[model samples]
Target chain A: MAFEQLAKDVPAYRAPGQQLGARMRMFERDKDELRKLGVPIETVELASETKHYRLASRNFYLPRLGFDAREGTARPPSKSAEGNRPPEVTFSVEEYEMILRAAARAQDLGHPSIARDAVAAVQKLSFDLPIIDPESTEWIVPTPAAGDSVILAVLDDALQRHKTVRLTYRSNEHGVVSRRDVSPYGLLMLRGRWFLVALDNRASAVRHFRVSRISRAVVSVRNAQRADFDVPSDFDIRDLSEERRAWELGDGRPISSVVEFDFSDAVAARGAELGERLTSGRASSRRFAVRRPESFVRWLLAFAGAARPISPHAIVSAWRAAAKDAYANYASADRGES
Target chain B: MTKRSADSASDQLNRVLIALAWLSDGQPHRLRDLATRVQVDERRLRSDLLAIASRTDDESLGALVGSRLSLDDRTVQLHLSLFRRPMALSPRESSAIELGLALIQHEWPRAEAAVAQSVRRRVSRLTTSPVTSSSNAPIHAIAEGMTEVARQSLQALRGALKTSRKARLQYQSFSATSASARTVHPFGLVLVRGMWYLVAHCERVRALRIFRLDRMVSVRVLASPSAKRGDEELRATLERGRAIVKGATERLRVRYSRKVAPWIREDFDVLEQEDGSVVVEHPLRDDAWALRHVMAYGPDALVIEPTRIRDEVACRFKAIARPRPRAAKRRSS
Candidate 1:
């Protein structure tokens, strides 16, 4: 009865034993409900004090989006809040400023996509806030914006639609670009960069691919021959990414290494328990369990003067060689030749 | 439950927003007819309208959502406020919202998949028209989730900030001897480099400092007010760090091989000298970290600066070569 056709059809077409005007009252009830939702139904005066109603689609939908600041929110200038139009939203002066602060900061430091979302929030909020001069504010985001939006878009679409994609991904570990069919499970943000944790059909394993290092635009092949795979219902991203550091990369068994460090300077910046098996003395030592052998050694090498691997004579000797090489290189550079 | 409540509140908020945007054209309509279009029953729909009315009158939403409601037995007429012209969100905004959801999906329990779905549904409903693009944009950032301990520490610090109390923080710095416990005036949090840091005033050090929340082993928020505490200059303090990490515009002279120079020059403020080697002289805060950074280049780059720091690098090499006095205690690999 909320629509005019149903309301008119209901009176003469009532169930048996229904009283006169009862269904009409119900129709009245339904009509009141629609009005609460903000739908403006046009009511035309009719014969015998009855009325007809219809919802105009022209007034129903919002303006087409693709909103650009330069083009002015797709709103006509005459329709400003200043005119007979309804009043602008009024947030507390302080709250309004804070929203601006958040928007400006987000635009600079936040992920480019998230920054735009913040901008959208601002656009929506502009109805309530004081006008801000965009030029006056400076944004500072250090990390380079991820350039390949197409790949990201494709991955996101694939994840949501449960569609399998033919991916040509350049492996970060090896610079080789390999084409494979993948079911992208999810997208994640780590260290200010996005990673697609997807199941690679070729490897038969879930791997996280850093979006930044991906070389070019993702070409979505509409190949009918490509088999679509379903993401495992029990797939949890936490299981794959946990305990993994940014520099740590590999799919190997764990290696336990014991290292000692003079924490005088390190502890001032980090703290005890910075590593596993925290201990203190003239020199403190911690045992580190690592899977990425190369990254572990490279990490240890950086701490050579401040920290040392006390074990696996192999690592000790490697550190010694690297140290000797560095000194020798420095000495030669001082002498103007290597 | 609280999460559910928060999610529902947001849903209702979106419903109200879209409803307001739709009715703001100064047209009159029967309440039930409009309710059918918005997909809500008459009772709940009426409550939503009351909620809006009371909210504007009680709080600060008044200027934005004025409406007129008239009911005469069988028919009702209503006109909502014209806050501004309603426009749909752009693709970038939606993508950002999705990325934010992705970030929290794995890391924070409060923003789990369920919450993400709820937010997504609400946002989708608010849109005047469906998003045209079929492709989903994967987010560009991935960060490790905080452990249970780190999460608890964050809660405790948040409590401390609310209470305006000092907290005893047992912090583990990377370059220190051992974990040190000190009282700090916990101010606020700064999320940078995929980690949360507490920007606080250290009582012992008598200076402002940033402590990585992940590195915090234990903490106890004190009951007393922080002595001589000033307003937590969160923006100023974070800005100081921001200038270093994000901009990286300050120039430095780094003498390195031509091969690695391009990579360095592209990433940092680098200037090449007439000599074949690069000199990296970025007035860095962490000279010790800087010393080791140069050391990473192995034979490629060298930092010739404050003699003491240079000597420290040389000492690292000597220590590396001066080993083998004790039995090499190797953990099983």
Candidate 2:
């Protein structure tokens, strides 16, 4: 087979009155699209002047996903290379639905970051994307908080691929906006804001980067699909964010901020997140290692007096002042005063 | 890369894949139906259909899925081969859903949680935990106090909102320590910083009241939609929420370490001092919250405010710091 013969054998299409060169360009463009979508095109040259072109069936197609009707449950399809071509990969409706349901659950929960990319990733798996109904009552969470959906998609991509992203981040602690190349560790939504816990390569420390503050249009510092560095095996995104609390995020030193909850109004997962054994034997109290005192106080105030400070004497006075302030506000509001 | 091209490529890829997924069901669908499902106009759908038909190399998607236009030209028919094996979710997709499920647990009614749990059971069967398979991203309820009673109240409120019925509840006002019977038209639920608030119209007060769901001990929703509409009130609440401080007059000034100061200043006004300390001036909304805010800073925050507020905070801290008889009994071993 000659190269000329192979080109001549290739299929040709001409839109009404389209020039031969233009039509050939269209064919070339279609070939590129197939390659980008992960289609494998192999060109075999026999001797100097002869060549052959064919689709690599084994290399190019998706393997199927779903349970065999006879099995009554999903079975792992053995992808044994039989003879001619490789196994094709494809997703069954059940597998596709499972992924979509998870994505829909994210959408209902007001987590756009998970919803957008999970759906996209699901398509990558099945090699197909399906539309989902937002109004479906199959599952629903009570409220939806406003959030930026794309940041999570980008960071999820970075994390999955283990890529470093050079992002312009606005630091809330210093009111300074600076750009840094960070290796994203993971994402945490604490205190109603999403923070990408990443290893700040320059500082050599893991830091919480508020997604809202990360400038839009974050750029990957390296070529796509290229890994510049590896996340340490021992590194955990949860470890980076499993700090004392969101209020204690930036504090350099650790201090104890002991507070007591009412016995009946206690946290269900008591002592689970409190790090160590409870210091007080009392059933109602939990102690936190605090760093940012002001943020702690504001957060504790939301408990609406159900919690009282146990060890920090200064906190009680602030609590009282806040109570009095609330009393005055309520009194005035009751009296129809603005 | 320019923003438009980057976005368009991703968007185009997503549309083509999604279309393929839908059409692969081996069913013939009207072009109108397909276009509506994908939320695209006829023109875009045709372009995407062309992309799919033209680029689906049999070496790739071609073997598993195929599509053709009907003679009428308005219907698209698909052909798909059965999958040999059950495809499982990727680790990242599973983890992403897991985080979402965890984050909304505060608002998850028992039924919804059960639904999520069942889905987790199915998905977990297929997923291998990423990395050492130990560490997971957690959604911690920073503001505690999600009790069973509060959960019951939440259930009732959810039913009320779903059915558009008015609810009667024993709700304790923040200023008062005792719970009082109140009838209200429930609007919707809002979870702020891990705390749940029920926005409703209070018939007794003749105003919109945002009741902390946890504050309600007993809740019952009865038949009958209220005369007042809830959507407007919810809209107003969300709109005014950004501008109005929780309280107008209850303001406090605290000097905090430079670190905590700027984060606070992200929301509240702050004054940076020559010594690198920052003073944050914020209104004291809820008493417990203000106290926790200050205490979260540990000793880094100092109250610089009206003498009464300062004295109250300092004295309260003193009371807590003092060792009680119960404490002595507990620790005397």
Candidate 3:
């Protein structure tokens, strides 16, 4: 047997020709290096003057996981890519599905760095699992719009190093371009748009800037080894990002108006809870304090016929006029009117 | 020459340790297979295996593998004590896991928050760098804004896809006055721009279709299994980019004004003219989407070809732009 033969050859294997002492010393040094690298190699003395070595725990090889069944099986499973995965090493059928979905989501993020990381992570996690072809799943996401990737890459690097960035930004309201030196706190995606939450040095206030509006960005290279600034401890990105509406991003005065939601779209109106729900007859409606009427009207147009602004003649008028303007662009072309 | 022998001492040590880690699984493996798996030379792998086997009795070596190893011409089996399974994740691998979980949480906040948090916590413990809150995370991906109906519909479609079942949806297209009910085999879901779309085989139309989640009034997963279809069909279409309506291969040329041409150029390949306007040929078969695409840009975009779509767009805009008597009356009152 191979074991019998190995036993007979054990002495020759250990001695290794004439450099027995040197080879043993080198092996010892190698062991120390592996230990320092967190290999978890543990040694114990056996009764017969022999040593026993083994890994301390499974945690060294895999992350400790406990799948919460309630969390995993909570819904029929439409909304999320990953559900309750097991806490231990074993993965349930549903958990496996969630992992695949999560993987798909990560690969589809459209950011090169994030996607690359996702692929690497999946490779590590699937050591013993079935070989998965990422192509089996699909994630259709928008890639960066031309110059936006450069902006994202720059911002990502600046955030990682805690550096101040200089940005040439375009104003949505004024159509004016201005330059600002800002210390980046963090970045968040809201309403399908990327916004950089940063402290504008000139403004002396932490404000969120739409990533798309920034035409040029350069990170401070002065302090390569040290961070240029510290992000304030109290800055929570969600506070500035949560429930932020397009109409509220402007500096315009707030306009109070009543918006009507058709019965078919009433559920959406109630879910948004824009403001107070008006007890209007069969159709439902909400009273809102809109900051930018044009933005608000444009958003309302997405609902097609399901919702419309009913009150505060100004908002209603703006809504009608904007729709008319959009209509004219299409209608006039047919009549040969520019 | 072995990759390890040519590598620096530290690299060689790392590779040998990694190889031992793989061999510690207590399973017999072919010598050639082990070398291939570890990306080392076969001769070097055999030497390392013999070195590990002979040192089983050495206390300083930490008993890396079994006290005795079974080795033959083709296969080697070792009883690994500490090196069993795989080694802890590298810093890069750990970062990948953390980032992936964060993305999953972003996509389905309500369903994946607890799982992502727990997994992240455990993974952070395994990682050299501890996990940080997503607020402090370098990249924060927030879920797109979706209505309750849309959210529910998305969930239903996902459930159907996982179970390989048919789903019924109340969907409204661009030109539809009201949502119409349809049954479809939920194949997969894709997110383009900010919208979630279900790529399915519509039973009613007997063709592949993509339905926007937000446009769906409601959705329900049917008990019946979906009709079988090759995934390649759907993959081939989406592999290129997000197409609104598949099989709309006819091209339509649209011109963007110079002011917005720069932005339009970012999203598509366009022919830049001397006058500064850019023209884009859209592979479109549907009038509804082409009109909406042009309408989205307001006056910045104009359709230059396919007069049929142009006329339809003009008619639709005329109807919408036509002042409603009720709206005019309410304002006057």
Best by lDDT: 3
Q: Write the per-residue lDDT of candidate 1 for residues B1-333, one digit (tens) a residue.
A: 000111233345445554465455556656775554434456666677666665443224632343465533333444654433444443444444444444444344343345445554544433333221222233233454677667767768767876778999988665455679989987666665456777777888777777887778888988889644344355555542342222334333346765456446434555666754445557556655666677766545665655566667767776677765555635322
The DockQ value obtained for model 2 is 0.10
The reply for model 3, stretches above 4 Å from the true place, is A1-93, A126-151, A169-178, A190-193, A205-215, A238-245, A248-338, B1-99, B102-121, B129-139, B144-152, B175-177, B230-232, B249-253, B282-293, B303-333
What lDDT tens digits, residue by residue, belong to model 3 across residues A165-192? 9999875434468998999886766655
Report the CAPRI category for model 2: incorrect
For each candidate, report what fraction of the true interface contacts it reproduces: 0.28, 0.09, 0.29
- Model 2, A1-338: lDDT tens per residue? 33345344444452356676776566656654444333344556667664465664333333433333454335343222122233233334444454455455444433454454355444444332333333221123222333345666677667755678887877754557798888877676664566777778788877777876776636476565356667777765545433246556742465676676653433312222343447557655677776555556656654434567666766666555545554443344346674
Each model's lDDT comes to 0.54, 0.54, 0.61
Where is the poorest 10-residue window by lDDT in model 2 chain B? B1-10
> TM-score (0 to 1) of chain B, per candidate?
0.56, 0.62, 0.64
Error of 1 at B135 (Å): 11
**Per-residue lDDT of model 2, residues B105-210, tens digit only:** 4345555566556555655554433322212333211222366677778877777876778999898755444679999987677654445677777899787777
What C-alpha lDDT, on a 0 to 100 scale, does residue B65 get in candidate 2?
43
